[model samples]
Target: MEVVATLAGMSSSRTEALTPSQVRSARAALRALGRAGMAECDVDGQWAIRADASAEHAQSSATAYRCVHDQVVEERCEYRAGGVSQWSVQQAAELKANRAREQAWWDGLEAPERAERRRARQEEFAGLSVVEQERVKIELAERRVRAGVDEAARHDAWVDGHTMDAWVRRSIERQYRYQRLPEPLQQAKAAAWQRHRERFGIARGTPLATSRREHAAALPSTAAGRDEEFLLVDSGGRTTRRDVETG
Candidate 1:
């Protein structure tokens, strides 16, 4: 069962409303009436009464019961009545209808009117000098070009290189000795060396041989693959030799 209550000290007039204590008493009475299966009733200028009644009669009696109940409870509770604004169901319905009508009126406008408004905005923009328009266009073009270049660079970096396997082989060969490398690795190393020399503008003939020789001379005497019996003489006249092997 549902119960409705009227606050006490609340004015029956919309301008001033009932007090909290009055509302509490009203709520309690409504609750009791609901539990007892009785509807609250009121006669003008009399105390509120609870009675067993039909639903329709109960609903109709609520207004009168609320008015008398609020007055009596407010008097007994000595509570201050507060102001309230009231709106009828009809008034609320009218407000909603007015809003919907306004929205529909806006929606009913012709496409041409909307287009005209858009064209007016465009005309305002077009009224700017030609040089300003050109400047704006140029800025937009530059921004697009920059964005295109950045996208292209990102795409290129993401692409897998066609020569990645060959490059890996060359790298392995460089780490190990070329003579000890497998046939495929050896070819890769040679290709890599030629490519490097070409990139650095080095001649592929005698000059490259001389460079390799000079590189070999820089290695320590104890380093592998050098002739062990060979001697190196320093500027101070000190001589060093590779140790002889005996079997």
Candidate 2:
């Protein structure tokens, strides 16, 4: 069961929003509500958390939110356990609708428009300061590393006979997660994931193509067929087959 908690209106009417510490405290409290299985929170529910004034006030409000969230969960537990819960049904429907809408929007874009958008994004990035550029680069690299690790885990799971449904679910979960990031970070994550896919040769219908190629390449060459002692075996999956000079 996935729990969605919204820190509703953390900002305030004041010129300045809540302090960083207060925001963190409030987020932590919201996570606690999620951990305790508050499946869905009402945006205008009877309970409210007004935390823009001070950190102490934010903490108190967070505690109050948690108490109310817990009570709501407890009240709904029996209905949730017995059959299809309203939250699950509603969430699934929303997800399906959102995906359809997004796909339609993407499909409606022309090639020239897409290319122009990409060029504009490149220009925007090039216009950033050196420090900002470095930050973006570092974030992109980290995302690629994370994606590689996740791909390896997925490959292992597939080898161990996990269902294809699990793989699809994991991918959808990742998509939903990065889509929620701020625009720049979201683009970086998406590009990193795209590069990860290319590195692993994950085509539309063949996710394991590169793995199979690497496995075939890893075998000793037909010309070098012998009881050769293996000193170092480096399987450069992306490079397929390359002779390494070992001194």
Candidate 3:
């Protein structure tokens, strides 16, 4: 009978499953053939059982053959099952050669040439320092001012050349008048106007109401006005416009 077993438990269970009578008979037959049961012998010498055995002993011989066959099949299955192999020396040597070639390529670059490239990059950055940036900003502001003046001149030329409506002329005149002031001065004047409106509780886009008395009251007492000019008042009151101007 042929027996099939998995590679995992083949060796242990196969030995245990062999009948005691069969083991004893196999041992006797091996001894009769001038072979020790547990001794190591050449594969060819073991196969010589067929030529030497009698008809009656043939069954025992076949049983021994079956045992050896199963052992060999189990070993071969275990070897192929894992799908692993050892690497050869030639493969390792090729890897080392490739690494050496890469290292040699890097070493061949000129040191002085690399340093020169680095220095050029540093010099380019040095030209963009804070002071250099500030000078560039001032130059740009001057250029912008000049360009605005040129644009205004062109616009005025166009307005004078054509007969524009009254409203268009007034709008253009107002824009040009505002543009004539320096940018910083224009910003300061706008901030002052906003403060003045807020303090006097005036609505935006409404004209400020001012009589002669109100105008004189708002101005300093140094000039002649309707308001009474007091003198020698208390410490807090002395700080007023009347005392200061009189003093």
Best by lDDT: 2
lDDT for each residue of candidate 1 in 13-79, tens digit (9 for 90 to 100):
4444556875567666665655545644355422344556567656767978999898777555543
> By descending TM-score, how would the candidates be arranged?
2, 1, 3
For model 1, the stretches where C-alpha displacement exceeds 4 angstroms are 1-176, 205-247
Clashes of 1: 9
Q: What TM-score would you give candidate 3 relative to the actual structure? A: 0.16
Model 3: per-residue Cα lDDT over 168-210, one tens digit each = 3333344444566689856765665465445434344212222
Candidate 2: stretches off by over 4 Å = 1-83, 118-208, 211-247
Looking at model 1, which ten-residue stretch has the lowest summed lDDT?
A: 225-234
Better of 2 and 3 by TM-score: 2
Sort every candidate by lDDT, greatest first. 2, 1, 3
In model 3, the runs with Cα more than 4 Å from the true position are 1-170, 206-247
